[model samples]
Target: MEQNKEMTAQESLQLISESFNKSRKDILRGSAKYFMLWGALLTVTSLAIYLLWHFTGKPQWNFLWFAMPAIGYPLAALMGKYDEALPQNEVSKMLTGVWRVFGAFAITLSAIAVFLVPMHVTLIIVIIMGLAECMSGVLLKNWPIIIGGFLLGVGGAVFAMLVKNDAQLLIFTLGGVLLLITGLVMKLQYK
Candidate 1:
C-alpha cells in the first residue's frame, strides 16, 4: 500500500511538471513570433535609414520610424486574436500579464525618449528591449534569450559611445540581428 502511494505521488509530480513545461513552451512560442517580426522590421528600417541618410543627407528621414506603429499594431492585434481565442489557464494568464507589463513599460519608455533625448532614442530603445528580453528569458528559464539580451544591451551601449553620429542605424541593426537569432533559437529549441 505504501509503495502504491509513493508511485502515485511520483506520477502526480511528473504530470505537474509536464503540464508546466507545456504551458511555458506555448507562451514562449507565441513570444518568439513577436520577436522575429520586430527583428525583421527593425533590421530593414535600420538599413533604409542608414542608406537614406548616408546618400541623401536627409535627417528628416528618421521619421520613418513612425511607420513602426502602423505596421506593428495590426500584426500585434492579429496575433492577440489567436491568443485570446485559446483558453488560458492560470499560468498562461500570469504569463500574459507579464508580457503586458513589459509592453506598457516599453511604450512608456519610448514616449519618454521622444521628449528627452531624441538623438539617443535608438540605443535607449535597444537597451530597454534587451532588459525586457532578459526578464522574459529568466521567467521562462530560457538561456538563449538571456544571453542575447545581455549581448544586445552591452553592444548597444558600446555602439552608442563609439559611433557618436548616425549611431541609430548600427545599434538598431545589431539589435535586430540579436533578436532574430534569439527568436529563431527559441522557436527551434522549444518546438
Candidate 2:
C-alpha cells in the first residue's frame, strides 16, 4: 500500500511538472492545431452567423456552421492524411466519459423542455448545439464540449419565454454570443 501511494504521488507530480515545463516542440505542436481550430471555428462561425442571418433571415436554422466541416475540416484531413495522430487513448476514454454524461443530461433537458415549454426555439437550438457537442465529443476528445450541450439545452428553455420576433432575435443573438464566449473560454483555458 505504501509503495502504491508513493508511485501515485510521483506520477501526479510528474504530470504537474511536465505541464509547466514542456518543451518548445511540445508547446508548439500541442497548441498549433488547437489554436488553429479555435481561430478557424470562431472565424467560420462568425461568418456563418453573418451569412445565415443575412441570407435566410431564419436564424432558427443555423445550419450553415456545418460548412466549416465541409471546407476547413476537409482541408485539414487532406493535409494530415499522411500524418499519425497522438496516442492518447486513456485521456480520450476519460473525455468520452465526460461527454457521455453531459450529452445524456443535455438531451434529457431538451426533451423535457420540448414537452413543457410550449415553444420550439429551445428544442431547435438544442438539436443544433447538441449535434456540435456530439461531434466534438467523438472527434476532438475534449470534455469542455459538454458545456455547449448544456447551454443549448438551457438556452432553449430560456428562449421559449420570448414571444415576439424582436425578442426572439435578441434571444438567438444572445445564444450565439453564449456559444462564442464558451468557445473562447475553452480556448483560453485549454490553450
C-alpha RMSD values across all candidates: 4.8, 9.2
Models 1 onward score TM values of: 0.75, 0.40
Which segments of candidate 1 are over 4 A away from where they belong? Answer: 1-16, 82-84, 87-119
Clashing pairs in 1: none
lDDT of 1 at 181: 79
- Highest-lDDT candidate: 1
List model 1 lDDT by residue over 107-141, tens digit each. 66666766674556656676777786677567657
C-alpha-based local distance difference test score of model 2:
0.50
The deviation in Å at residue 94 for candidate 2 is: 5.5
Give me the displacement of residue 27 in model 1, in angstroms: 3.0
Each candidate's lDDT (Cα)? 0.71, 0.50
